[model samples]
Target: MSLVSTLIIADDHPLFRSALRTVVAQLLPGVQIVEADSPDALNLAVQEHPRADLILLDLRMPGVQGFSALITLRGQYPAIPVVVVSAVEEPAVMRRALDFGACGFIPKSAGLDTIGEALRSVLEGGVWLPPGVTENAAAEEQEERELAQRISSLTPQQFRVLMMLADGRLNKQIGGDLNVSEATIKAHVTAILRKLGLYRRTQAAVLAQRLLRAESASLAELGSAAEGGAEEEAE
Candidate 1:
């Protein structure tokens, strides 16, 4: 296959973006690099450059709710390769990223060489991950994977409705935001619940909350690791 030409780095941190840009320049010389600090910007970038070779997405960026943006990006642009680059290094989080359709997951703490290898592997149409991670699923992880599959089955519009529901938006409010009728929003809600095998809207909200908690925990762990690493370097 051809080499990657245009790459998008979607992260809110300027330092991280700069670091990644340096690595990309070193590994993939002469490639065009785009920067997006939020999900909205990322969407716009994709719309403007539909043929971008790769997108490195951060999970905790603004204008995105946990993995919702990743799911939406995969749904909308299945042709583009997206590799999640984040500080969250939890195996469960990594598994969820792959389940949500990321081609690779690169921890922020990884060395530049590892990041380069990941980008090269992804460009060569191979999935990349840290050592010791496997596709094998535990029983509970399998259930979560099934749930993620169901969630991935949602249409883009239905996914938006589900996200609004998780945000506690009323049908009328959601309809106003989507410029559709309350009846239409209600229909989407019904479909979302049915597809997710959920009984009540509250259950969907609870599921969303669980995902948020996992992301938050991962971020917390990442912060602690960063701090510990800095202390170790100082000593």
Candidate 2:
């Protein structure tokens, strides 16, 4: 039998998923393309799509598992390669996805050729990153250096609070958004700033943004919650 690129595409957007279907149809031809409208659907489909060569996952889907389903699935199916296909193009997320076992990261902005090329590279057992990764090597090193210097002592909640600060949400707003009291947000921010040895919130915000972005792609791979949340709030 001819090799078929059996794929399971999981995303919350009907339009995006449909577009993906079209792309697969046009490019892979005889390949088998399965669809899952949400993270839960993807979880169910994973069992069905056994021997599936590829799983194109959307980052920031929803729920806690949203951060880690890929790693879990990979552990279960070591032979299958999972490609993080997301609109989140932040460099932080890109590196995290790779760190969490994603074979490739295909930003939504990528063209058909780019997507196809990545798919081919993954199938060939190579890490499929854009040329810019090497092109941006110097900046990449600088970022890692800065991160190592800055985030060496933050607690988990302090880290999360710092990221909300980066998102430009105030203590009250962050508290409300995260379901914590403003006092707690304040405390966390104080802790984060102290740990990072930063004098201003702006510095902390910038650093947090970098850290969040770095965690972006892999954030999706971290669990199944994000995808589940995507389903619950599907538009």
Candidate 3:
């Protein structure tokens, strides 16, 4: 609706990111484009560019667990809209992405014209879905939604700690990586466990793992390991 000025492209694949960037430039010439290749980088990009008009996100990016990153971004920055540009073209996945707060779902298989059309529509405050992917008004499971809400409540730093914990990082190591005292990381871990209604760090790790499994059965083969080695190592 407003003048499009800035957008964040959050995808791990450089070729796909370049394709999206080209389409975006054509759709809105002179628009500032910021690229983030991982979940942590996306978080930092959002922090650095809070007024971005939209975010183009890839669900399977390293350190991202299904819709966890989307949910967290929507929760933290409700004003900014996100569009899922992913290779996983399952209709169920597209619908679930919309249910989780993405304004649109554009399959990576889409032609450049279709991708531009989808981006244009969403940028103008419209919802977009690929052909044959109709919106399902059916609600998600109550338990799943509740968990999403809890995860969405996390502050960004807490989320980083949670993901690092999922990677089996200890408090001291997390502190060193985050550049703070071990006690601060311990506090963050405590806050994360309490907010997620868990009792221990392992539970938080398991919760992070569960978020990876949030997709439909068709995406069972897409494991966190697929993108893990490609990301900047926390170790």
Which candidate gets the maximum TM-score versus the true structure?
A: 1
RMSD of each: 11.3, 11.2, 7.8
Question: TM-score for all predictions?
Answer: 0.87, 0.56, 0.69
Better of 1 and 2 by lDDT: 1
Give per-residue CA lDDT, model 2, range 77-163, as digits (tens).
666788888877766556556655678888998887888788777777777776575312245354443444345345545655665
Candidate 2 residues lying further than 4 Å off, grouped into runs, are 64-66, 135-235
lDDT of each: 0.79, 0.65, 0.78
- Runs off by more than 4 Å, candidate 3: 12-15, 35-49, 61-79, 95-101, 131-140, 181-183, 212-235
> Clashing residue pairs in candidate 1, if any?
none
Question: For candidate 3, lDDT tens digit of each residue in 102-176?
Answer: 899998899999998898789888999987767663354444445555677788788878877868888899899
Residue-pair clashes per prediction, in order, are 0, 29, 0
Error of model 1, residue 35, in angstroms: 0.8
Best by lDDT: 1
What global local distance difference test value does model 1 have? Answer: 0.79
